[model samples]
Target: MNKYTIRKMRKSEVEIALNWAAKEGWNPGLNDAQIFYDADPEGFFVGEYEGEIVAVGSAVCYDENYAFCGLYIVAPEHRGKGFGLALTKARLAYCEDRNIGIDGVLENVEVYQSVGYKPYYMNHRFTVLAKRNRAKNPFVREFKESDLQEVLSYDRQCFPAARQHFLRSWIYQENARVLLYFERDLLLGYAVRRKCVEGYKVGPLFADNEEIAKEIFLAIQDDIEGQKIILDVPGNNLPAMNLVKDFAMEEIFATMRMYQRDLPAISHEKIFAITTFELG
Candidate 1:
């Protein structure tokens, strides 16, 4: 029998986990390591066997009531062993009874369900070549430091819990651009575009309505024109589905959004895109 050591991962070791994710064709953002580490330095965990790290996972507690689990990966040569399960247990234990969420692939849905996770909905990842839209909305503007409070307030309507620290790191990370739509001093929505391993990804695209969502989405693509753009949207949001179809984006991937408890009651309609599978 092989003994596996499971424990919290150091900040610097996060890159190793992300590299494994990229090798699995997950297309992680280039600066994800720093941003994710900043989200919760104590949330990431690793499993080692005979002094060699072989698996990784994360269970980020956004608040006392909510946590998210993801980035679960085992080295290709280390799969089929119990290392992955050990890492998963370690992360779950760290979450400590909080309502934990995860975006998992379909093939593992049953595996997750067996461990007390229930599928809530599907999140589809769509991709398209960015094309500049000449329509410019005056209300859409670059995000400023002063807008952080209002942005975080608006974010809570779509997300499950307060993630001020994570949002701060996500918006200001290198190779990322944050944009917000404001009208009459009211924060309507915001969006983030970041460079990924392959191209770029726009996420956490929140808006009061489809028009506002479209505005932020198109505006964020201004500088990244001609690059591949990715968006992960909830299956239940019909408006979000229509918005992506209007852009002629192709569905490239999908994940089952599962939770260990009841789903959080938030404004799902406002969420045009989720942050990321590995972090949400």
Candidate 2:
């Protein structure tokens, strides 16, 4: 009989893991497979038992100093067999010597902590039905090729690491919309809304302040009125919490942003919404 083994997943195998993520109710973006694969082709991994895949995880190393771990899952029948633990260890080893981040579910918080991951803050997922908004700000416009550098520059201010490749594909993905808040030569913020398994999700809603964030949020939903909208708010940002409460968005899920080392220094208030819990 073949023994269990761990190996790096191929690009096509990434989608198979994403399918399992969808079945687990993660609501990943429809175009996430390619974008994720492009982020770090060598980041995704899988565990096979007796020649059959049974577990998966990711340890995307954005740069030498920073990495994110996520998309961890084990087939229901394979739980408690140590396959998941082996996969986790493999991912950790792949990301060693870097500050690793993960949005771990609350139930697994302690489990992660025991492995040297420290909880930094809570991220709450909120959902609401889109509504028509007559407000239109001339400063807000659809992303264009000319705006790539400016967007990346501003995005770096909000995100912890530089992920130009990931951001490039994320903005141009099919069935998605990327909007920017610019005033004259100043690129204040930007947002991306993508179709998910159920409805739509607005993320990486980085802004200079709460007002700009609100405008971009409502603007993204203007055309998708009445459709389900989801946003993951960081608990550390009071304005982000207030923004969701102002819309009466229902809280559906939550996770702890944990790290294996020192957390990267970033503009906490400017990160209105995280890009993705899976890849941080």
Candidate 3:
């Protein structure tokens, strides 16, 4: 008998899964565990085999209408025994009645599709050596606590779902750099840069045009000079593709964005870069 049991993961267990993710070359953020936990405490799940944890997954529900599944991994020694599918189904069941989404690796696309997920677009991860540039935008300024409401409002326009809880932690986390673009009292765009295992990542980069995106991106590099910077851009956004190419960034990774239901209406024109694959 296959004595494998699936259950919600404890807070500490999330860290273990993150370690597993790093070992798998995912390069997760340093404080991602706590932030991910806060997003949905009951979202993370693990499979125990003979009382030894062997598989993990997450079904983080952002709200009643939307959820995201990620971090699905089975122990190397436990692969080829249906553990991955078991964990995946557990996550799917958790997000019952909500539109579930995932940033799936290329190899898992068919597996995800077999279970109702349909590919919508691709997210290409790019990296470049951070160089100090004098690019300056007068409207760009450090994000302040007072800007939370406006930031949320602006972000809602760019993303399909509202993730205020995740955004709050992401913006306020230690060693994170967040910048906002405002013109004549109107918020135009924003970008967040955070330290990662390999270097730093800039994401959730929303802008009205390539110039605004470039200015904010370069400003972030200026703050953390000499470190490699990574950004994951939507494959369909031609201007975003051009933006990275202009900076001489190299494509390092890619994932297909899939959803279990009809794709939600999001302003891809404003989304120069996605927030994070694991959570969105």
Candidate 4:
């Protein structure tokens, strides 16, 4: 039998793990590695077998109270050998004492539950080919650098923790298009559209109502016209579900949002789209 060791991942290895996530059809953002690393530099871990890495996982602690675990993958050749379970256990240990959250793939829900995760809700991924549509909201405009503070303030109401660091990088990522909705100087909502391996994705879409969400969504889609666009919405958000259905987007996949303890207090009503299942 070959020896196996689990150790913290180096910054350079973050990209490798994200690549594996793409291979698994996760469709990770282009600049996800840096933001995730910034969230918890020492949180990602890798399992090595006889000097070759065979598995990876992340337990990124956002604050003392909340942490998210994702990017869990085992090499194709290393499957059925217990590497995945070991890596998961290591990640769980790393996130000890915090309310852990995971966006587990449908098939792996049972596996995660056996390890102490309980399903809170389901998030569905929807994709639509880009089509031009004029946004009628005159108040909608491109995001300005000065709006960062206001955006973060609104974001805090939607997420369980204050992820200022992640928000800074996410909004400024290369080839990203961000937009904000305002009414007479009051920031009503914001949305970000960024290039992904397969196409484009719009996320962290926070809005006060269905009208504002639709306006921001159309604006981003218009900005990135002619590319595929994807969004992940909570199954419980009826307005978000109706918006996707109105655009005729197809449901590509789904994940169960699991937590180790009681769910965190987040304003899901205003969360039109989740930032990233991998990090949140």
Candidate 5:
């Protein structure tokens, strides 16, 4: 076989990587690659065979504690030719024994298991809403570019890796809205949403308290009025579990959000929303 090379991702390669993601039906956030690159500038990678990009992957490493391994893709023509395995190995090698996480396709579990990752959890989407009417929080203002950095920072701590590019675009897109909860000049938490055909959806909502998260959700509803807002909740998180079950929410679909490595234990009590089942 001709020499196939793997190298750290370049800014110019962002389009190709993002294009591949969209082709895979991932429904990735707008400008996902940019924000992802911002968080871990050089974390992604591409594999080339005789100058042709055949595969891509990213090990979005954060310090030595946590990382989210994602964006593993191989061009369709190269599927069974060993590119996918090589790309996966390349990305996973960067994390080694650190606490790494992956939200992967259910069918890929066996293959991932062979690589030393165990299934740690699952995820679900709640879409039904109760009959009562709740108004938006007064402090829940519209999303602004100034809020990008803070949102990214809050998101980074919640996940193993960061996607600064995706966050930047999604937070600022015309169809998306970001609402924040602050306490005494401190950013307590924030939530981001994007317009969807079915309705507006919220993910990556981070807060210090469930009430704060609820306020943010209400604010987002106002921001995108008269639309069905979707919420992705980690099935195992009790607060998220209970809150989703509360008034004005119904079950839609479920998927397993598994992790390869268990990082520092997150406070499930404070985590009422997951960014997304597919992206995070």
Candidate 6:
């Protein structure tokens, strides 16, 4: 048997890592690894044995208080061995603090729990109305540099800290559409959507009311071209919950956002959707 070694994932290896994620049925967004690495290049990693990569994952230490670890995958042929656990433990060690979080599949919760990981909370991904037949909202537009201060101010009210690096990388270009909601010259909310594995996903959906949230959804629907759309909504937010129901989106899967620490204090009142179970 060849000895296995763990190392930082190269930019070229992102495809391999993503393929592993796909086999796990994670349904990652398109260019996701790019966006993520662009945010923090050192976070992603992989395990290689001989000439083949046997396992992969990431430890995105956005900062001291909130670090996230996910994208864990091991080849099916190597499942029974200790490769998975070893790779995971190595990834965990990369995190600087105890605030490590992850959105684990139900099947492997116990496996993760065995090694210091714990249950945090459950999350859901819903399929919303397709925009093939009707026009989407006109308010939604591409993100621009001018919107920086506005987005920063908007993000502060929602998340605990200013994830400027993550936000900037995710909203890198005009393609990563960041929609804003306005009424009488006031910035009430914002939403972000991008292409991923299955189709388009709008995450971190933030809005002051159901109406604004609904409007942002409509705007995204217009661009999807009948493709499937996915969004993970927090179980506690009823307004955002009802808004998805209003649009006739179907709940496809329920996932638990597991964490070694308590869930951070986020503004559920204005948050209609979270960016992703893995990152946030």
TM-score per prediction, in order, is 0.97, 0.97, 0.97, 0.96, 0.75, 0.89
Least well predicted 10-residue stretch by lDDT in candidate 3: 131-140
In candidate 2, the residue pairs with backbone N, CA or C atoms under 3 Å apart (3 or more residues apart, or in different chains) clash, namely none
- How do the residues 191-259 of candidate 5 rate in per-residue lDDT, one tens digit apiece? 877755356567777777777877777666653445567787876777677777664588766655666
Q: Which stretches of model 1 miss by more than 4 angstroms?
A: none
- Decoy 5 TM-score against native: 0.75
Candidate 4 deviates by what RMSD? 1.3
The list of candidate 2 runs beyond 4 A from truth reads none
Residue pairs in candidate 4 whose N, alpha carbon or C atoms collide under 3 angstroms: none
Clashes of 4: 0
Model 3 gets an lDDT of: 0.90
* Tens digit of per-residue lDDT, candidate 1, span 6-108: 8889998999999999998899999998888888889999898989898999888899999999999988898888777778877888899999999999998
Between candidates 4 and 6, the TM-score winner: 4
Alpha-carbon shift of residue 136 in model 4 (angstroms): 4.2
Q: After superposition, which runs of candidate 6 have C-alpha atoms over 4 Å from their true positions?
A: 132-142
Error of 1 at 224 (Å): 1.6
Residues 1-280, candidate 6, lDDT per residue (tens digit)?
3488888999988888887777777788777877777666888888888868888888888777778887778888977788778888887888866588787877888988897777866678898556852645555555668987888788877765678988887776335678887666677778888777778788888888888888887876675667888888877788888888877889887876777877677676888888876677
List per-prediction Cα lDDT, in the order shown: 0.91, 0.91, 0.90, 0.89, 0.70, 0.78
Q: Score residue 121 of candidate 6 by CA lDDT.
A: 65
1-280: candidate 4 lDDT, tens digit per residue:
2499999999999999999989988999888888788778989999999999899988988888898998888999999898899889889898888999999988989999999999988999999988777646688899899999999999999888888888898998898889999998999999988888989989989899998999889888875678899999988789999889989999989999999998888788888889888887
Per-residue alpha-carbon lDDT of model 2 for 6-112, expressed as tens digits?
Answer: 99998989889999999989999999888888898888999999888999999999888999999999998998888988898899999878999999999889889
Give the poorly placed runs of model 4, Cα more than 4 Å off. Answer: none
